[model samples]
Target: MGEGIGFEQPETVENKGIADELGRVLESVPPKENYPPDRELQRSILDQLPENLVEELHAHLIVVEGGKEAESSAEESKLRGELFERLATAQYGRAEAGTQDPRLAEELSQELVQLMHDPRRFGLEEQIGGIRNPDLAFFKINDQGKVEIEAAGEVKLGLLTPRAAHQIGGGFREGTRKMVEVVNRMEKPEDSGLLAVAQSRTRGGYLSASENLKVKLIVPADRNPEKVKSLVNRGIFPREDYVRLLELLKNKDEVEILKSAFSRQEVAAMADHLIGKIRERYK
Candidate 1:
């Protein structure tokens, strides 16, 4: 399959043909909740699917993501470490087929796809990395003939060693300090400078506010509502800032109402609904 087919080069992906299919698959989606309406159907479907299906899903994710990149061995190794960290995390990932343990590479593949479809608009993985066998690279032809790619991936949450996630997040923070030393012969110093991004944030000393500003992370969709809500009450995610997508389902043209997928108001409302019904037996 082509790289774009796997979610690579997504920026340029035309939203032209899939409108019909969306209406159908999405038909089964229940009405929006004042909160995240219990996703009973989605949960049931996910539960009923055979383990092999998940395995196939996992394998395809791995093969496709691996195929997306064609970087040098050094870069490939670096990518592997990043993927590994995502997998090792406990919270952000799904169970592997036939086992509770997660397949880091596979989880990354799925997450990569979500990242490419930037309906949420956080430019997480956009700069510095070039294309190799990427699983879900989002690319599009810009106003110029050149292509701009944004590759994305997922990992089970909380997988990294304490030091590792920070290191990887830091790589994201300041990509290629070491690369500058190695590949600087032909490009003039200014041209080299042109490639720099987010350097100011890195170069500038971290102000107290920059370090202290508490990010309002959305509460992840969990399997157990009461237990999860208890955690939320304790501030797992800043509950006040929560907005759920399900709440927006009530409004037909949510663009004006919700703004984006990650809108705070909608996500928090959805979280409230979801917290009501995560575990049917318990509820």
Candidate 2:
């Protein structure tokens, strides 16, 4: 099995101390009624955090909150899209076949595929047509230990409206068509191609449109199975056989996870890079 940046275990005593201190700092913030707390008050809280913790927390908050409300709606939308994309990548990256879905066994049994985020940033547009390229691409490790594109996924945030549903279904068709052509020309082509769509919420008018898209629709799992069944009945999702739910992290949960994922030294290194950005933005 291929290794990912999985969470580290056996937390060091020093790391535990840092987490405790950070937790206390976070808890000190006044309730939501007085939210967007006083600038000086926020700064004082930031001051208590180690430079690195401040940076990590700031970056995480941007992802979770989609930046300050004062920012342009377009910018906020972009940030929210980014958050969803990263969450989808993390969810699939750590997925266990049996735990997530027995249907995933075939994909998970092979040399694990690494899912790349925003492949276009790596200047892959020429290799994979710009429109056809997905927000996330699955590159499989072949028998010879060579990595090659195996599948693709698109992520959509916000309610799944009619337009969004059309985009999702159409994109799946186009992407699959493109992948079929590319794989056919490959020296060692796989038998099938896969495309997936991930959305923030399952509520919307997508059921009829997506009935025959041949794409896997991934949505965050509700804590109650009955809630998910309700969605299926409402036609927000297809039948039970077609539903694939992933548990995504909430803002607070993500904060806690980030605290445990980094070591003191790693945090310090990241902090150094983010210090200037944080200062300029927060000020």
Measured against the true structure, the TM-scores of the candidates, in listed sequence, are: 0.24, 0.37
lDDT of each: 0.28, 0.35
What is the Cα-based lDDT of residue 259 in candidate 2? 13
Candidate 2 lDDT, 1-283, residue by residue in tens: 7888866444333245444544454445443431332334322323333334445545665655556532444433444444344445544433333332322323431222211222244333354454433444333332233323334444444334333344344554565455434433433222222222111001110111122333333342211222333223324544432243212112222111111121222223333333435456775
Model 1 has an lDDT value of 0.28
Cα lDDT, model 1, residue 247 = 27
Q: Ten residues in a row with the worst lDDT in model 2? A: 198-207
Q: Write the per-residue lDDT of candidate 1 for residues 46-154, one digit (tens) a residue.
A: 2322323223333433455685423344333343333233222222234334431124323423443333333133233233233212222222222222222222222
Candidate that scores best on lDDT: 2
